[model samples]
Target: MKKPTMTQTLLFILVIGIGLFYALKYGNKAKKDIAEFESKKETNTTTKEIIELKYFGEIDLNKTEEYIDVLTNINGNEISIDLNIIEETISKKTIQPTINFLENLHEIEKIAHKQVLSDFKNGNIVKDYIEHHIGEFNDDDLKSLGIKTTDSPKERKQKFLNKIYLKRIGFYPEEWDSLAIFDFTISRDLTQYLIVLSFDSNGKFVDIYTES
Candidate 1:
């Protein structure tokens, strides 16, 4: 076989060097792509897990607004007066008086009446109420909380109402007409309470949940 000339040897070395450089560059790119893909996979898994853990199925925008309207209209023309009475009663920890007032309003459904009365008689005020985001529970979690799964969303909401006492209403400063505020006491002893019933900008019951 004929030996390669010096120029041919140089060209061969250059080609090998170029090939090695490109191989390293492309290999590193592939590794980075794989890492990014894995990160995305993990993020998607976390999101799916969160969705599966949700208790509330979906928010009914129309129904949410309708409830707000019903509560507001039934409270009468003086929204501020109703709000003040509620806020004051809750702040003073006068549980029965508030229950009576709420009953008279006939706005929202009757709350955990017996428990509220018992708490008041027992000198409990639900002062330790905490906030929670909606869909923070699965079926198992609802069962644990003594909340049975209902066939329909309406039934589910009704069941939730039956378990808690609505004590306060904090209307958004400007958009009072478009909101539903429920500050609930969840335990007979007033130890467990839901600090806020959240709503999204679209008046959807998205983050509605109770905090222990």
Candidate 2:
């Protein structure tokens, strides 16, 4: 073929240049997208399940009246006495409970009992005691406490503050009418934020969240 005309040659070169530029841009975009996808794949994902975690909703410490109102609604006509036996440093030789559930630690501890725990460990009586007396949720919740127990009565007498694997069920005597096992706890560090709870034997929530 003969030499192409100037304009024709220029047009051909322009088309090739545009094609090359487009190829480069698309290649770069594809590479960037792949790199982003790989980066995302390296990260871990978490899942969460929501559930009602309180009584009468959440109690607000700032709104004293609000707590009073809810407490009235729940405590009024309910079989409970506002025991002013105000304990200053109430501590039990309670064995630290092994944390059962990671996500909802306090909730699991709420329903725990001494005898039931003794049964679970097959003979870990001492640990159950420490767990009940100690706050239930403490990070691992006593996962590290290596306490043991036994149904076979302690061959040797248990001493005071003697760390043991035991369980505790804080409930009103069976003879009492209209039973209410309203168990509550607060931060052992004097954060009197009441851990108010109200539930029946059937897992029904009388007061689902904080009264306030």
Candidate 3:
């Protein structure tokens, strides 16, 4: 085979050098774009949007998984809280309600229990009550409380729910025959609270009694 001329060799070298330069340039640009995207994502996670109570919508009361998750993560630390453990903790705090709001205590006890079971199955009871009772606070209210978020309204509301969850005081249980009534109170004070949640047997939320 004949050796290549100096001109041919020089041309080959020049082509290879140009290719390498373009490759390096492209690689650096791609890495910079990725880095910028990641930085924005981290900033978003660190500075979340403020959530308010008015945005409360349908909740999956049957799905305790998310509830346990928020309860554990309220500290801003990612922790896994087992459902069984949470239930046990709630049970320990369970007590009889100071006032039984049920009108027909004996009659409604069974009815309420049955209703709760049905609602849990239908995934509507807790959702309905929450829709009816959650606060009217808006974005302004959340800002006043020092809660900040860039998330959508629904996500904001969920964050607010989780935050308030950590302030839960205890569970109060009231009995009427076999029917069970439990009041889960959350507040800075044990006696008075921001909200009182009433649930029946089978861990179904029945009503919410709030203090104005």
TM-score of every model?
A: 0.30, 0.27, 0.25
For model 3, residues 1-212, the per-residue Cα lDDT tens digits are 99999999999999999999999999999999999999998865543222121112222222222232122232243222221113222221222221232222334334433443454346554334333333544556555544464766565544444444323222222232223332222223422433434445334445644452
Ranking by lDDT: 1, 3, 2
Model 3, which residues run further than 4 Å from truth?
1-135, 144-149, 164-175, 178-181, 185-212
How well does candidate 2 match the true structure, expressed as C-alpha RMSD? 18.6
177, model 1: CA deviation in Å?
A: 20
lDDT for each of the candidates?
A: 0.42, 0.33, 0.40
**How many residue pairs clash in all the candidates, one count each?**
0, 34, 9
lDDT for 153 (candidate 2): 31
Per residue, candidate 2 scores C-alpha lDDT tens digits across 61-119 of 21212111122222122222221112222112110111112123234333433323333
Q: Please provide, for model 1 over 39-84, each residue's C-alpha lDDT reduced to its tens digit, 9 standing for 90 to 100.
A: 9988655311111101122222212221122234333322211222
Candidate 2, residue 143: the lDDT equals 28
Best by lDDT: 1
Measured with C-alpha atoms, the lDDT of residue 125 in candidate 3 is: 40
